[model samples]
Target: MKKAIFLMVLALVFLTPQLSVHADGPDQMIIINKVNNQLYYFDDGTLIRQFPVATGKEDTPTPEGAFTLANKIKNRPWYKENIPGGAANNPLGKRWLGLKVGHNRGHMYGIHGNIRESSIGKYVTNGCIRMHNNDVYWLFNQVAVGTPVIVTRFQGNVEEFAARSGYHVMTWDGEMVDEFQIGRVETLRPMKLYSYNEKGEPIAMQWVPANTRYQVYATDGKGTYTVGSNKYLLYTTPNDTKYELVPSYIKR
Candidate 1:
């Protein structure tokens, strides 16, 4: 009995460090939506924060795919093409989150702050994701090294991609909608339609008829709009089915 007890204690000691490390493991996931020019931050499967970002230009498009946050540097020096870091005109803002993108780990691309605050919502970067100085500083402190970062140019809105990718969908009002619902707002032009479940799971993909119209009652930040008193997220008629939002019908 004594020998068994001693072995158990040794095992407990060995497991303690492992448990502690896992207890403090990374709890954040970042998705950079290139199409919408937005950055979404998720903690433990829930979206906790979002920020507008500037992506790469057409000629120098931002690299898309999965990457790991490999390094975090504050006030990093910039010496690209003889442009010194800390210069008034330096593009690197106040913080940098370097990425380990695939086999190219030479610090070629990353997410950083920019001095040009006006460019926050535009696609004007050479390739890196640019954020406001305050925003980057906040993000730098929230995420730790080795966190997972996915940079992708989504085909639709962030909500659609998030639902399709199995991430929890958050409404603009901060409500969590687990089941996927169709958007009901009709667009003047035809658009692709996708259906999803409460857990943000995709159920179907199709195309809507062109020139459809609907009276909008409500909208969810994820591109879902309600129509009529029934509040149907999707409206189907004999000749047409609609889910895309009409920009003019939006309440603002």
Candidate 2:
């Protein structure tokens, strides 16, 4: 009962939910969902802002991972295009949140404002995430260096996605995730769909059919998978007394 505050609040709010970051935990976090083409910003576990964003095309998919804000830059120069920082024609735009995806620590790719406002919400970046000029400026001011940055492509609201991904959530949920690949899970026996409490702990919601299959949203890398809207299925622990549940993953 003391583990799922994030999920319950999100279920209630449906749009924005606040999560309290524990000691040494990052109070500021940014999540970029390529599938939805949206960006969510959280401060001290509370959702502060969100905006439409543009990500990489299929051929140049954004590198998905749990990164940190390596640096913050205003009017960052577009070196490849030879456009100076603060240039009206620069593609990097008015602000930059350097997402450290590799050894380069995001000097190569990051979240930045786009020269083309119409590109927001579309799949068009070379690899970096794109936001509106003003939106990026707002985001750049909201967080400091070393903030957590998660880039994923899962299908769910922020709370469910983060909780299921094991972001300091309740229960046996394991290590935090950088990204979520689509997955298929087969239920061995009948299982009740579960919801989390205010503390982020699981509470049985309703009974689901036996031997059924579901395309889950995200896994804790332990066993539980988010199967439905704010719903979870503990596939590893079944009522049938047989342990035959097998999960498969798809490359997102």
Candidate 3:
């Protein structure tokens, strides 16, 4: 009875704060609506801001997955043939928030503004999430580097990707996705209905993989997942030559 009382007290001590936060809570979260083509910002359960956006087309669509604000560029030029000369019709407007999506296709995908406000809510661009010129400028002011930026079309659950070391980069239709990063992973590891850390530590054994059109997840807690040519690295060198050496997991 004494041991049972001690365990009960310990559970209450840890769980009390969690329950309190969930109840009278104000979530500090941001939301992106793919159907409405709008980005909504929230602080403490209240809607703070919203912005019009543009998404992908039918084919070669903008991938829907959780991402992060990798880097922010000021006064960047639009890459493609959106505009000819200077900043007149530049699709990227004045700011660029580079999003590191599951597909590590670089800044080829991000949240920026276009000169054409009429195309703000339509299916335009190769596979980028576009916003209005002024709206993006405001958003640039709101978020900082490394802020979470989930880009999805389904239910909005933001599952974070593991570290670069834990991710085994593989090309799917020429875009990158994370698999279990263990060396000698022969088969595609069965999606274990649980959550893992960047170092493959099991967090919640009851966790399930969140569904996004282009989402990623770790399969198991073993050192046998596949990467580029094998199950060790994320990307490979030219002609299946070598793998990139990523750093080991950094525990906080």
Candidate 4:
């Protein structure tokens, strides 16, 4: 009895309450549409994948707003049901990405794995979002703490929805989204700088030394990469066989 009581207390601590919480460079983001029961994942503002999920029922509706993934837990035990972590009967499946919903320390509300695959794409839960165990496993491996998560029922494209949420980055009609630095772009040949205008049109700005690198701020999604608020460079491939382009940094 004492052991059971201790377990219950521990579980209570882990499920204490709710709270709320930005996007950063080349970061991972999660946006869930409560209206459609879908979870969209993005990397650097690019939609990577989406999965069907289950939100809370009417009485225990999932908290809808902007939040951050404050923590991650693996094989979390379902102590309320007396199920051990990693057990077949564990309702939390094998992973948990807890959200900082408002004021609390991201302990209570979360996106977790559900053993019941049929529960996905349906309204069923206390307040958490339910995903397939496999799906959650994949997401858990890709995302990290401090990742931004947006939960809303807004009607718009995911990118636009994220933009309206206030912390994400997205371009409007091929325009540069922001001044945040993407990375450094090296000039493969003699290069010159151009001014990036509000329309994303490149205008001859100034002259810079050839065979030099510059800190890239943004891109127009065509071939034009920006260097500053206005300065940018037109990246192009050369037919020269002497040198080939290769990434200075590779990300998994």
lDDT of 2: 0.65
Model 4 bad stretches (over 4 Å): 1-26, 167-252
Q: Sorted by TM-score, highest first, which candidate order results?
A: 4, 2, 1, 3
lDDT of each: 0.62, 0.65, 0.48, 0.66
lDDT tens digits by residue: candidate 2, 141-248: 878887767776666556555544334331111212223424446677666778888998888887777676555567766676776533565646434423222221
Please estimate how well model 1 matches the true structure, expressed as its whole-model Cα lDDT. Answer: 0.62
Candidate 1: pairs in clash: 78-85, 178-198, 178-199, 179-197, 179-198, 179-199, 180-196, 180-197, 180-198
TM-score of 2: 0.57
Residue runs of model 1 more than 4 Å from their true location after superposition = 1-25, 82-84, 155-160, 163-173, 176-252
Please write out the lDDT profile of model 3 over residues 40-82, one tens digit for every residue.
Answer: 6543223456677888888867766545667778777765665
True-structure Cα RMSD, model 4:
14.5
lDDT per residue (tens digit) for residues 86-185 in model 1? 6677788768899877676626788998989999989999999999988998998899886667677555444434434433334432333323323334
Q: lDDT (0-100) at residue 3 of candidate 3?
A: 9
CA displacement after TM-score superposition, residue 111 of candidate 3 (Å): 0.5
Better of 2 and 4 by TM-score: 4
- Pairwise TM-score winner, candidates 2 and 3: 2
TM-score of 1: 0.56
lDDT of 4 by residue, 1-26 (tens): 00000001111222322322252422
Residue 81 Cα positional deviation in candidate 2, in Å, after optimal superposition: 2.2
